[model samples]
Target chain A: MSDEAIKKENLSEEVNIREAGGGGWLYSDVVKDHFFNPRNFMRYGEEEKFEFNAMGRVGSPACGDEMVLWLKIEPETEKIKECRWRTFGCGSAIASTSVLSEMITEKDGMKIEDALKIKPQDIIARLGGLPDRKIHCSVLGDKALQAAINDYFRKTGKHERVLTAGAKVIDSVLNITDKDIEEAVLEGAKTIEDLQKKLKIGALGKDSLPAAEELLKFYLEKYFKS
Target chain B: MLPKPKKIREIYFDHAATAYTDERVVKAMLPYYSKTYGNPSSLHRAGREANAAVNDSRRKIAQILHALPENIIFVGGGTASDNLAIYGMARAHEQRGKHIITIPIEHHAILHPLEDLEKQGWKITKVKVNEEGFVSPEEIYKSIRPDTVLISVMYTNNEIGVIEPIADIGRVILKYRKEHNTPYPYFHTDACQAAGYLSLDVEKLHVDFLTLNGSKIYGPKGIGALYIRRGIKIKPMILGGGQERNLNAGTENVPGIVGLAKALEIAQNEKEKENKKMRKLSLYLWKKIQEKIQNIKLNGPEIGDDRLSSNLNITFMDIEGESLLLYLDEYGIMCSTGSACTSESLEPSHVLRALGMPYEYAHGSLRFSLGRRNTKQDVDYLMKYLPVIVEQLREMSPVRMEKQKHARYK
Candidate 1:
């Protein structure tokens, strides 16, 4: 056989094994598309070129991921004219942020309130679905968007209109809040056992057990269909 | 400017993950599967033929390691060999002590088993590694105790490809044994990665137990052997028939044994030439990457005698490793990463973390392990797309710190 034919045969054999063993492309085609051709990403050294009134950043470098978002808003209309972001995260994080940018700025712009209402589930759904371990990445985009909107509100002297994303305490004794439960759900807490393993939500006081369990179920239903 | 990037065949650069089976080894194994297929335990002509194949294979491997054939025990795979050596030796020597000395940069196959041993009342002292992922013999010597039962250190790290000072560490153990007038603490080295490139002379290394994997050396998967020193008692982990001198009990894998022996012979014979070629290619790959990509930190030892010739791990600042890996996969260039997102447990590589690498740098790490099939053309092809991919990912990344800031951590 020719060298090229032998190479093709070998390639097919390896590819077959990889696909059969679930080592092929990890994400959906949508996720791959968004990751490869991310929209509205602030190119390196081009932060100054984009006109933006408000900026927000989230995640810590120590946590292995961080995201910074830049937003240009139409003041009179209270609409986001442009959304650009940069993320130091995995493919899911990049895809989520890319799709979020498109969601907010597609067909001109989205109202600031509407953009804030776009949940992590929406971003994940638009990308087909992220891996269970990677669902936390989608939430980062949502939180960063809220952070930017709050920044816009603070800058515009609309202090009362500014919203706190996760301040409602769900477990009073442990100071664990609904946000903690929501995050646990996004991080693959499918059952109460998984939730307890992650957060130890009601370990301190029995009083918050029912509440924590209730919130866990609510977040589970909100994120996962089950 | 550049001609439209031509569609290239897949470049298998993840040899450190696993290697393609060599045709010669397969050819050697074919006859054992069909013609000489028999239970080695059975008293028949076919059984005797199968048994002879196993013995001959063991002899070939023993010759390479400069060990006796009777000392080698065939096991399932690399992890099985490690598990057997650790649990078997530890269980047998429990009366001596429960203490074990190891380094933090060992593969999960070793570390996880050690963790299990720790839960079973065994004391494990993990010696720290230097910034370049080197565990000093002095530190290991200091960690050794009267109660220390085993010293398990890998011959070469699978991730960063850092070659440990196993012989020096072995000599330290030997000196301790001599001074204490006791053979309580036995030394073991997992030479799965080193079998293809380095020496496996058990006497020169002064190791009591050495692990070798078949798949890592272009042999069949699901086959490995552990070389135990003569007269060093180790309890069998698997219990059934009287096989492998009653140290391991299972149906003998005649084909796998033959293939492993054949692959090891070929690897040993071609070791020097292949190492020279890979060393030159790896150094060239690193140089080209440095020239093309900015703010990239080379993980582990410099590409020389201290590091495996086929391995090159780099941390491209600002971009997450999983994202970079995926982009490279698009170009049909296969590699692996130590990034948290790529790992199932969502924790960054324990090996990189043990090296005191910051979380961001650890998440950005990528390992490109070259192999026999790789050439300068593969490296050139990688260079053609790697810079563009890194630039794109960096543009999308939010962490915009100067490399000098992270250099302090290094």
Candidate 2:
């Protein structure tokens, strides 16, 4: 069959490309667009070329995804003049960060405060929705943006405005923090035994055990609604 | 207004996922579906004709595998064949023993059934593979216990295409069975990936049970077979009227069976010629990719006799596999990735993990499995876009290989 005829048939039939014979297109058109031609991404070895004051990094390579956001903020209006990012992640992750960079810097750039308020849902909606399992990919951009905004606040000497999500140290002996515990809970650790298996939290003594258990309960309830 | 879709030429390189049905196989199966459509169990003339076709196909498959026709039992697919071999044998022989041995890099079809068996108080020992994804026969021999009932391994790994020493492991099992004077541990090999490329003679391999899938051999999907050595008792997983020696009881898939037989015949006849062509093309592609792309690591055994001629799995450092896969798809080049982001559980491929590959490298791996339809021109087209896509992704990636690793690539 002719290429054009096959394309026409595919479009008319509306065959879900993913279900077709040989691993056809898997993402939405918008995702394809962004993934193919990403917006506001720093070119390779050109991170220093774009003069950005504050930077935030989230996720980890061990987790199979990591993202870094570089933002140039205008001091006077607290506006993000430019937002560039790089990610070691999947197609959904690349698309999420690409769209996020546009949303933050488009239309003469959004205010840093407004950018911080943008949730993963807004990013997913803008990108025509990611797969259910890929919702976590969207969250990387939101978390990285908050981290960058916090960096900006710290840079501007607005110490009180620096909102910590879960960075505070909860266990002094193991140097385990609330953020570590929260991540453990999010990673499917329900009971204190599971958390202990992962983080070895309360290793030193029984004194910190109660506090760790309390924090684990709070995180479980916060994330799982249990 | 919607943009007009561009006419992009497609280049398929994911045959490891599944292959397109061969036209010859399709033609062979058409008559069974329409003209000779009859339940083989029926006593009528039409049913007898259908039964004859099934028997002929069974004889052809048996001749190829060097096994008797009665040893071949057809099932739904590769997974079904694997489930039958593992679950059927384990359940039937549970009174003898409850321990099983397998390599960690087995396909989920084998691993999941073993996991289910584990919940039933069965002990599963997953012998580790080396860095090149080669399972050691010595380790398999050491892992065997008096109570071990089955030892399952794949002829060739699907993800990295590393060819295990199945015949060697088979020899070890034979020695153990003779020395112990007990037919306690029966050897099984999942040869779905090896059917089209490697030898399937059951006598040479010394396997009690072997699995073959139709889809992997360019036949119809949802059809596969398990070769059970005669006199080895196995409980049936699917219960119904007597069919497939009362082991797999269901209406036979005559068309699929016919197609599978034809496909296997063609595959065996053309195996040497296709392997030579595929080896040359795979080497050409890998050499060009290595020369063009930087910071890449070959995952499996250096593409040669130790690996399938059609397989090339490479990890492009600092870039995730799924992003590269999608970018390649934009140009109508299809492939697969071992990246966690592509899977439902958000974990990298268990095969890569079993190779002692770190999470970073595992997530960056991509598999290119060539097939009968692919050619040198197709590899050229892939090369044209692959380097560009890798470079693009690397630019947008925050991770960088250490200087030592980068120097090794250089």
What DockQ do the predictions score, one after another? Answer: 0.53, 0.50
Candidate 2 global lDDT: 0.85
Among the numbered candidates, top TM-score falls to 1
Residue B162 C-alpha lDDT in model 1: 96
Give candidate 2 misplaced runs (Cα > 4 Å): A1-25, A165-226, B1-7, B403-410
In model 2, what are the clashing residue pairs, if there are any? none
Candidate 2 DockQ vs. native: 0.50
In every candidate, what fraction of the native interface contacts is reproduced?
0.88, 0.90
The prediction achieving the highest DockQ against the true structure is 1
- Shift in Å, residue B139, candidate 1: 1.7
Task: Write model 2 residue lDDT over B1-410, tens digit each, in one string.
Answer: 11223566799999999999999999999999889999999999889999999999999999999999999999999999999999999989999989999999999999999999999999999999988899899999999998999999999999999999999999999999999998868999999999989999999999999999999999999999999999999999999987999999999999999999999999999999989999999999999998999888899888889999999999998899888887787677899999887876677899988877777788899999999999898888788778877887888999987837434332
**Docking category of candidate 1:** medium
lDDT for each residue of candidate 1 in B309-389, tens digit (9 for 90 to 100): 999999988888998998888788999999888776677899899988887788899998999999899999989989988
